[model samples]
Each structure stands twice: as structure tokens, then as C-alpha cells.
Target: PVVAAAPGPKEPKKGQKLSGKIAQIGDNGVFVSFGGRAEAVLDVAEIRGEDGNPTKAVGDDITATVVSVGETVKLTLKGKKTGDIAGLLDAQKSGTPVEGKVTGVNKGGLVVRTLGVRAFCPFSQIDRRYIDNPQEYVGKTLTFVVTTADDKGRNVVLSRRSLLEEEAKGQAEELRQKLEIGQEMSGIVARIRPFGAFVDLGGVDGMVHVSEISHARVNDPNSVLKVGQEVKVRVVKVEDLGGSSERISLSMKQLESDPWETAVDKLTVGEQLEGKVVRVVDFGAFVEISPGVDGLVHVSALAPGRVEHPSEVVSPGDAVTAWVTQLDADKRRISLSLVDPSERSERTPRFDRGDRPPRRRGESNRPPKVHRSGDPSDGLTSMGEAFQRLREQMGE
Candidate 1:
């Protein structure tokens, strides 16, 4: 006698979303029970993290869309069977975000399965900036907003960029309303441009200008800052951009104790100390006597004999013993005289007003002084320049 096979449960249509619990696991894959005869298999690799551990377990509730209907159904982490054209229209009209799974990467951009429809997300719309490796997004679940939902070829255009920007804007506005000037906070370096490092403050980006990166002079920001570096910064400026958006200027050095706060007591006049020659300018060579502290060695003090140029006596990076001749704490100036090692202890430095050559008529009786740094009067532009540089980097 011949026997006929019994009929199985009805097949689930492709793109149809289903929620169920993991019923069993084996070498082939995980079998998900649809609470009925129909069961779908999820790739074992798909439900794992970097640690190679399963993110789901037996009886764990999981939601997936029927990607293929065969003898055994296949499911993916796609969104609410919004794969219907009507569901997409509702999302487009409501500005609601829909979930999708990146099925694959193509030259145009990513091929996404959302609302049960195949959508095209241009490469530019994948991120706020250029995306170098689009493949990294494959098999990953992400949220997106419908940009163009025309029913032609079932053309459904989506943009993760739009969703990200909207979220960022809302977050930025909320932060601005509560963010106070002079507030100190920690942030991650998000982007580094020619002018400065853009720090991500939760959602808003604040600029840490090149001039404010540190107390030490930095010609290249890249030399000190790297993307994703955590830094403590102080909010120095906040300005409204007429609406929800605003600009924030932050300073790293402000969070640090100004090195010149104790300059007067630290560098006593006539004291001899060894320092490294940091810079050799036309007027003199600047020596770093301490961290974030530089003193100028005038050309006249380069040697016992007349010196035509400061460089003629000391080149940069030369370690030398020099005597403090003059210090103007209010002006943040320190004058040093390079002396022969043998004569360092023989005589007091001839740096006081009593030892100075007589001033010509109309000249101040004070000793001549040149301030190369610390006062902020010259050598470097301050906040205005910093903000301008940031503007150029932003194209604003």
C-alpha cells in the first residue's frame, strides 16, 4: 500500500516580519518557532558579537523578517513588516524612522531591506562624512528615514544621514539650552582639521582652537591630538546661531593651571639655571626654563663680546646655563643672559637699572625689554584668530 505525505503549514511570504522564540540550536543554525508549524532559521553567525558568543539563547524572544521562503524559512533582523508600500508611505509622511538591515554593498551605496522593500541609500547619505568602507555596514541593522518613497520599481530611497542629522540637531539644541559658559566637561575628539580639533560634547561639537590646544606653542594640531582621544575642556564661548543651533568654543589650557601664575616667585633675578634653547628669533633665543615657561636671551647677553645676532651665539636645542637678568611678572617677560660656565659664579648678572648703560635723551630710565611670549600682546593672535580658523575649516 502507498501512503500520501501530509500537507505542512502555509509558507510565510518573503519580507513578512515574524516574532518568535528560539526553540532549538544545532550546527546548521538556530531554529525559531513561529508559535506554529512554520519555523525559520537564523544564521548562527548573525546572532553573535565580536567575542564570538551568541547574543541570543534558547527561548529568547527574537524578531526577524522572512527573507526567503523555502522548505525551511530564513529570517533576518528587518523591521516591522512595513515592507508594504502603504507602511512606507506612512513613515514618509510621519517622519518616523524605520529599521532596516543592510543586505549588501554596491557601487551606488548599500542595498537595504526595509518595510519589505528594497531601497537604495546613496553612499553620501550613508554618513555625515565620506564613507570609505561601506562593507563594514553589511549585515548590520540600522535605522533610517525615508527620503524618497516613490512606488516606481518600488523605488524606496532611504537616508541614515538624515536620521543622524535630525537626532544630532535635537540633541544639540537641548544641550545648548542647558549648557553654561565656563562649564568644564570631558569630550571625545571627533574630527581634526587644519585649524583645530572638533570635540563631541554628547551630541554637539565644540571647537578647541589651535591656540587653545595647550600652553605650549603648537604649530601642528595633528601632532598633539588624535581622533577619539578623550580630553578635558572648559567652555570659553557660546553664541546662538539665531535658532536652535549654536557655536561653542572650548579651551584645553584653560582647564590647566596657567604656568605663569607663579612666574614672579619662581624665576628670581640674578639666579643661574640651565635650560634648553627652544627658539632662535632675530632679537634673541627663547629658552624653556620650565614646562610651558620660556625666557628670552637677548642678543646683547649672548656673550661678553658684541653679538650681531642671537643665533650667532646660541642655536636652537642647545642646552645652556643662563642668568636671569630681568623679570616682569605682570607682562610675563623673563630676560636671561648666557654666561660662560666658568664666570657664572664669579659676578652678579649686570641686569639691574644701576648697571645698565645710560639711556639716551627721551628714553625711559627702565632697562630695555622684549617680550616674545606669555603676554598675548604679540607673537600669536588670540580667540579671534582661533574662531576665524575654525570658520574656515567649517566653510562658514
Candidate 2:
């Protein structure tokens, strides 16, 4: 009698997932049952727990992926695995990312435990930006790419910033496709400067100038924005600066109704309003009538008479009353005349009654010399001749 032919060793297909019980744990790798005589062998380094140690026993429930099928099925934990010295070295050469937990911090940098070995991550390597509080990273597990490593993995160095940079580079094209003028997006404030705040819009950076930060005056960007704060901004402009560089202008002010729109409706000619002087120039002073609305008080209208400069009559932060003489909403211009309290009840802001101003200091208190229609002394006297009278009195 002929016996039925026996089947060859059952081979698992490449990338096929397998679920089985641990058959054996050896110094080289793990052995898991794969139904028939064909067994699954996986490197011990593939399944390291979060504490940087291999904590598996025989017969333990485990899952693995079939990476290759030779005489025996070679298995893996899929994706990128980092749990041994060999793994870190491979990552260093291949530029693959590894996993690490920030255990503590030191003077030089952070102390990270990865793949059962301690690694150093310098403060500068933690992020693309400066890190103020290094301790905040403790107890956080992060992915890192190996920058340097020795054969024993005792001198391993890692950087998260490099990985972030690579990711940003990879996403740049996608970001360009998404950005559009007038489109609103949410982002985190990455940094603050004197002129503006830089917001990280995923993989790109957008600038919100201080003038665009608010409708009210913003003298300091720090007062209105902070690092890592989430904010919504509208894309006002997108310009290609050059190859590999672009500019994005964002605005927070444009999201709200302009304050000038309302201020213009209520401000009519001869309307009296009280405001604080916000700026002073040689020609005029700017008085803020509302939060973001202001009017110009010309030097001629700053005082009851002629004003040499606006600073002489009105200074910054000075509270004053003024009447609007001209308001142009389309031009965003308002002309104001200061209301001198001394003559407010009798006349308007302009006090040009054609009266001679008071004499300046160290000047003659006497009026000008009056003469007949044909007299020689017609408001004109030579300095030497005029002082001759004083000379005769003093005998000089």
C-alpha cells in the first residue's frame, strides 16, 4: 500500500502577521509556535518594554510580523524598533528614529534612557527653539534620531530637532498647497520679538506684526502674545521671497471689525469728544478718541493761538477735549481743533480773534512807537539811537 505524500515545511508569507504562544526563549532570539514544524524566530531586541529592558517569558502572549521566510520564518515587531545597542547603531547609520524617555536633567543636557542604555541629548538638541525649562521634559517619552553613537552604545547622542526638521521639510509642499490669502488657520505662537510674533502653522512659520496683533495699540508683543500660546490668524499675504524661502503675513486685527468704521459714523463736524494725546509731532498731535481711532490736531489748532510745536501745547498721555472739524472715513483722516476751556462757552475750538499775543520774556513792555501819517518814527528805531536815551541816563 502506497502512503500519502507528506507536505513540506509550511512557510509564512512575507509581511504576514502571526499570533502564537512563546515556544522557547533563547539567548539569540525567541521561538514561537507557527502551527506545524515551521516556527517563528524573532530577535529579542524587537520587543523591549518601555522601561528599557526585555521583560518577556516563555509561553507569554506575543504578536509578531513575518519579515522573511527562509528555512525558518523570520519575524519582527514591525516599523522601527529600538531596544538594544545594535538597534541604536543601526539607527545611527540608517538615520532612522529611536524612542527614548527623558529620565532626568543635568548641567550639560538631558539624561535619556533608551534601548537599555543611557544617552545624552543636549539642550540645544531638544527642540528647534531655545528651551527655558529643561525639567519640563522629564517623564515624557519622545522620538529621537541618533546623531552619534559608539560601538558599545555607551556614548550615544540623539536629537529630536533633526527629526522635526526632516518632518517639516517633508510637509512643506503640503503646507504650500493649503495656504491661501484670507484663509484662517489655528497655530501655536512659536516665538516673540519686538516687532512681531512668529506662529508655527504646522510645518511653516507665519509672522503677525505688532501692528496686526490688535485693534488697540500694542507697544509690546509680549503683553498680548506668549510662546506656545494657541491663536487664530488670517492669512493676509503670501509671497515667494526666493527659492526655498517664502513669506507669510498673518493678522489678528483683520479678524474683527475695524474700530474706525464705527468711530467715523459718530464723529461729525463740530462734535466734541474727549481723548488722550497719544503722539506729538512738530506739525500736530494724535489724540486717540477710541481704542484704535484717533484724529490729528494741527499745530494751529493745538492752542488758542499760534503754537510753535504740538509738544508745547499737548503732550503724550495728556487728557484733553477737542472738536472734530473734519472727518473723512474713506481717507481714515480726522481733523480736530483743541477746545480751550478758557473760551469754550463763548467760541469754538479755534480762538483766532486777531488779538496780539502777550510779549515774550525780556522784551519791551511798551507798545510800538506811534507816529502821524507822515512822521519819521513809524514803528522803526535804530538800536544805537534807541539806546542813546539810556546812555544819557547812565552816562555810559
Candidate 3:
């Protein structure tokens, strides 16, 4: 009878080590099935990878330490010395910056899912460039630095801009070496500011100044160009003012046509043309006869009658016939006259009159009038005296 000792019933206890298969994975946590029954709940923070993603996934058979064995056994990878989730988190916390995909975006920031962990990246931390629409970042992968983590390890904050700024700092040096003045390169318009547009030239960004957008004057970069427009630009200047950053000046107009050349050809003195009124100032109206070809009609020359302001005579978009009275080829200045008789048929006066004197040899006809002062009975004076007295009387 010594052969059969009663086998003791297995004792279930709390804080015991166990192994299970991951039954399900969700946004909040993962579920695992232990030997005896109900599944165990593991928070997302407790089930992370070395890179910060979940270490155990659905259908994964893994060992976990049981922290509580009641109606349900609560297992924590963090509690296990052998299967320490903290080790994974610690490794993630210590490792180099990781790459993340922008999964969602909101008013405050972007929701980035990286290494199985969800992180919040504030708008300021999203990119180095100004982000007018942050929603564009969704589904894009970016490198990010872990700026903060919650005590319960629930909320992790990330910063892609910090990583980008660091990377740009290094790349800027390299770009400075390769970038030379007058070098032509392709770029995308990254941002449009009041003063200029920032162009993304490969790794570095250069500025396409407002004046450089066109050979003609540019009032605003936003008017002529927009964000994300691809354009070719020339490097106009590279100034190492010796600050924290170097300034790179770029120009799109330089790569394009010289407006002055076309303007000089298209707009010459005595060139009669029709134009649309572009602008009206107190001094004159600016008419664009062609692309980049503009002429200014002074207020005095706007009409046969006096005009206080050019706007009084013509509004914007009005088509008008004008004569190019003067042209400065080098300065690209064209003086126009709206009142030139050739421009308006209705404004010209007729030469035919019934009372004009008869034509003489080599003499043109002149208008005739009744001679009241020269009548002898009315004057009663010498002809010269009468003419002088009449001239004085008429205040001639």
C-alpha cells in the first residue's frame, strides 16, 4: 500500500507564475487565457515591445507572472522578473528615436501609432515647416523623439519636429557646401510668407524672395505662387552671416524670361495698342497691354477733359486704346496717352466750316467773321487807331 500515496490537489495561489495564449488584442489591452478558466487582462503599457509595440499579439503563447489569482488571475509582464515588460519599456525608453506613422489627426495634434504604442504629437512637434493643415500628415511615416511618458504609462508624447530639426541642422551644413550661387535646382514651394516663399530643395530649404517670383514687380508671393507648387529656381545668394543658420536666397525669375526684354520689344514709343486697366492711382492708370507689358497713362493725358484721379476716368478691367507717348527701354517705363486724337475718333474736331475765308496761293483757308470794329460809321477814327482801340476794348 506504500505504492499509492494520495496525490495532493493542485493549489491555486496569487502571485504565481503562469503561461497562456493571447486570446485577443485591442486598443486598450490584450486578453490571455490561463489554464484554469477566465482570461487575464493586460494593459497596453504592460505588453509592449522593445521598440514600444506590443510584445505579445493575438495567438501568441507567452509566459506571464500572476499578480492576483482571484475570480480572475491578473497577470503583468511587468511583475515577472524573467518576462519583464518593464525591460521592454526600459529598452524602448533608452533606444534611439523610432519611426512612427501618423495614424490620426485632430485639432490639438496627430495620433501616432509606433511600436504598438499610441502617442500624441502636438502640432508644434509634427514638422519643421509651418503646417497650415495638419490633417495632411495622416498615413505618413516620420521619425520621432519620445518627449514624455505618463506615470501609469498610458499616455506617451512624441515629437517628430525635434528629430527633423536635428536632422536638418546636419543636412543644412551639407547643403551649404553643395549649394552655390547661380546654381539651378528644382524645388517645391513649402510655405508662402508675406516676404517670400520657402522652397524645399531636396534636404534643405531656400527662400524665393517676393521680388524674385517674377521679373515684374510682385506685390505678394501668395498671389503669384502657392504652397506645394513645383518650380525650378536659381540660387541667387548664399550668405553665411555666421549665425546659428545660413541664409540661402533663391530666385525663380532668374531662371525664367527677363520681362524687361519682352517689355522693351512689345512696348515701344508711338506703339498704339489696346490694354486692360490693371490699376488706377491718383497719378495715373496702369494698363497691361500684354503679359508683363504695362503702360502708365498720366491723369493729365487720360482725357481731353481734366481728371482729378485716374479711377474717375477708368476702373480696373476696362479696355482702353492708348498711345505709347514715351518709352524708356532700359527702365521698362512706357508713358501712355489716352487723349491722343488717333486713339479716339469721337473726340476729334471737324475742320469743315461755311464761314472760312477762301484759300490763297500757298496759304491755307482761315475761318471768317463779321468785322464790327472796322465799319467807318461806327469807329469814326483812323483804321490803325480803330484797330488799336478795338483791341484794347476787347482786352486782346
Top candidate on lDDT is 2
Off by over 4 Å in 2: 1-83, 151-154, 241-245, 265-274, 321-326, 341-396
* Tens-place lDDT digits, model 2, residues 110-151: 879888777889998998766778889989999999999987
- Note the residue pairs that clash in candidate 1: 82-115, 83-115, 83-116
Q: What's the residue-level lDDT of 250 in candidate 2?
A: 98
Per-model TM values vs. the true structure:
0.53, 0.60, 0.60
lDDT of 2: 0.82
**What would the per-residue lDDT of candidate 3 be over residues 71-186, giving only the tens digit for each residue?**
76677774432322243356457855877788777668888776656677898887776677887888888887777765454677788877777777787667767878889999
Candidate 3, position 113, lDDT: 72
Error of 1 at 63 (Å): 30
Angstrom error of the Cα, residue 213, model 1: value is 1.3
Q: Number of the top candidate by TM-score?
A: 2
After best superposition, candidate 1 residue 338: deviation in angstroms?
3.2
